[model samples]
Target: MSIRHGLLALLERGPRYGYQLRTEFESRTGSTWPLNVGQVYTTVARLERDGLVVPAGEDEAGHALYAITEDGRDELRRWFTTPVDRASPPRDELAIKLAMAVGTPDVDVRAVIQAQRAHTIQAMQDYTRLKAQALEAAAARPGVFDPDDVAWQLVLDQMIFQAEAEARWLDHCETRLVRLAPQAVADRREGADNPPSDGDGTAEQADGAPQRSPARVGGLRGALRRPRR
Candidate 1:
């Protein structure tokens, strides 16, 4: 995806101007990532400014042809070997708001979870509509002459996959939260039962009886301690 580096590499093979490099790069890639003449010229200028490439000669119109210098070849090699860190994907604002809802005081976490489940179900409905549309469109197409049409099917497939996945995950979250709601309420209740006073549950509540959370293995889920709110 580094057009700059790719251009330098092509020049390393031989001196070539913008037009030739642009044509060749496009033909080689089956026009996957189209290169414009202006882009090629701009990249060449930057390389020249960086001392990575120099003007080899000129054609009849005095159009500059560039050749990769030793430094340019070195840079091209480094580019081939060095990793380019792709930019992290954009934030999902919905996910951020959901996390906030989970942590916010006075918020009913169960209600928030239900809302998320509903939202995901709505998304699944929308995606299902689009999925049907894509299937119809693909069936209508006889061949892959238009790459855009080909890609449209894949886009719809991906959207469908993601929507269904979100719905399933949301359903799981809702179900688990429903099961845990009574436990959470009971833990917070002030005094239907006695309250613990000692490190062990030895001391009595203000009602003159000891109360504490039930002692259990709590399966694989609860040796870890949550921090005090």
Candidate 2:
């Protein structure tokens, strides 16, 4: 997410070209967030512009190298010490999809949740397999120390944990929906039996058709409105 900071962090080690920095970033992160060569160069250029990095001559192979400045080091240090802000969370597509599905007519919200659960579980399993492989490699080379491997393992662990948490949250959503089903049905029936007027002394459903409001469908929509941290 913070490509600039990441680049600065890598530059702290030694001077590196755009390609080398991109490679190192992917290698350290297990390619979880891949960066193209252009992106690397773009970020480096910005850092140079901001005085966080400087164009350090060139490598022996003629590649343009970049070195971090004092300002860069200070910024990297602050980034390391500061906790990531979580007061405003990023928009989760799955959360938005589920919320919309719950309110939309003729949408099977449970099916959507189940499908996402399956996908998330599969991802978790894949991450678990990768973690096992990483551990096995580490065990085989007990006498050796590879910081890259350690970094990758940490990244994989975070992804695995996130997937597991998502699966659990999906289960909770399913259970809550099931528990509220009866009440939802009752509300729908009541709404159908007593349709609300349209303020012109005429029922909105003048044709005696049943109307399903978001609240009448399920309290799930209301539940989604509350903030969760």
Candidate 3:
């Protein structure tokens, strides 16, 4: 989420002070991406420097206020219209950790996947609870539509979806590892049982380095599947 563009979008509604901008942004996004007052002011300064925003006036409390400029409006419009670049998706730390864990000397790859799956499931449950609360509160309110309640519900829904996806992906990783592991073990046994031969099946590598069959040169999949003692 681009905080800069988000601030500009809020400003388009009207002139607002830095704190107000921060509050409104969080309220709309359910505080998923928090912005400190200092960060808000810093981004506001940059926007002013870029001619995307301008000082409007001071509020009754003497707080400095800003309003979006024509350029800022244009930028916000472009942001809304432009699709977020997914060609190079943001780095997922869990994905990186699991990728590095595969075949890692002493790391329990299955344990890592299971732990993450559990954590994601917990988060999904939390989000579900929050959604239920939001829905109940809205229902009690009758005809009055609360914007904040709706915003929070949407944020909870997004979090639930992401958590569900992560859980599914973890399951997929585990299944793949299980299926590939036995084949890799079989390959190793085949290679080890039948040493490389020189046509007559009586020759060695000659250099004393154990030889692996041509078909099993790079079978590291079994390494991820820890062998039972």
Leading candidate by TM-score: 2
| C-alpha TM-scores of all predictions | 0.44, 0.84, 0.80
* Model 3 pairs whose backbones collide: none
RMSD of 3: 9.0
Off by over 4 Å in 3: 186-229
Backbone clash total, candidate 2: 0
Which segments of candidate 1 are over 4 A away from where they belong? 1-92, 190-229
lDDT of each: 0.73, 0.90, 0.88
Instruction: Output the worst ten-in-a-row residue range by lDDT, candidate 3.
Output: 217-226
lDDT of 3: 0.88
Report the Cα RMSD per candidate: 11.3, 6.0, 9.0
Q: Number of the top candidate by lDDT?
A: 2
Summarize candidate 2's per-residue lDDT along 92-128 as a digit string, tens digits: 9998898899889999999999999999999999999
Model 2 pairs in collision: none
Residue-by-residue lDDT tens digits, candidate 1, 1-229: 3788878878977989889999867654445479889988988899899999999899788877899999998988888888764333346765667678765788876677678778877877886786677568767877646544555556556666876777676677668778987887787685457555545444555566555553333421242343344
Indicate whether candidate 1 or candidate 3 has the larger TM-score. Answer: 3
